[model samples]
Target: MTPTLGFFAWIIIGGLAGWIASKIKGTDAQQGLLANIIVGIIGGFLGGWILSLIGFDVAGGGLIFSLVTCVIGAVILLTILQAIRSKK
Candidate 1:
């Protein structure tokens, strides 16, 4: 996908993934929609990179794979964020 298209796609995936992560982490009440989207998108990129590092390809397989990977990343990110916040 082109950069612009990929960005938009990530935003959508991130938003949904972030929402899911928030629910799973029990932090939904503390985050807004935009924050969730941003976190999810960044988390998706991070997750994809980590997966790639482990020799797991995240490309292709349509939106399902995208969403799954993004969600996984968002959950990780959210968990870390919660931990950091707790420390503060």
Candidate 2:
């Protein structure tokens, strides 16, 4: 079965996750609302992909699951961004 989330649920979780990740990476000052949402949703996708690659079952989960997964991905994303910026 496909993992599905309601629109509002997705937005809420994504925003929260993104905000938290930004806080962790010290980039909260650089992100706006829409950017947070976009980063969050994409982070979710990235998290899912990473989990799948690691042979973890990432389906049929709840908010905490999604939050943890997205946070991990967002951390990775922010780390990559910082690395690229430092190289520039």
**Residue range with the least summed lDDT across 10 consecutive positions in model 1:** 1-10
TM-score of 2: 0.90
Best by TM-score: 2
Question: In candidate 1, how many clashes are counted?
Answer: 0
lDDT of 2 by residue, 1-88 (tens): 1248888978987888889999999999999888777788888888888987988777866778888888887878888888999999
Candidate 1 residue pairs in backbone clash: none
TM-score for each prediction?
A: 0.86, 0.90
lDDT values for all models: 0.79, 0.82
Q: Which stretches of candidate 1 lie over 4 Å from their true place?
A: 1-5
- Supply candidate 1's per-residue lDDT for 28: 90
Candidate 1 achieves a global lDDT of 0.79
Name the Cα RMSD for model 2.
Answer: 1.7
Q: Would you list the clashing residue pairs of candidate 2?
A: none
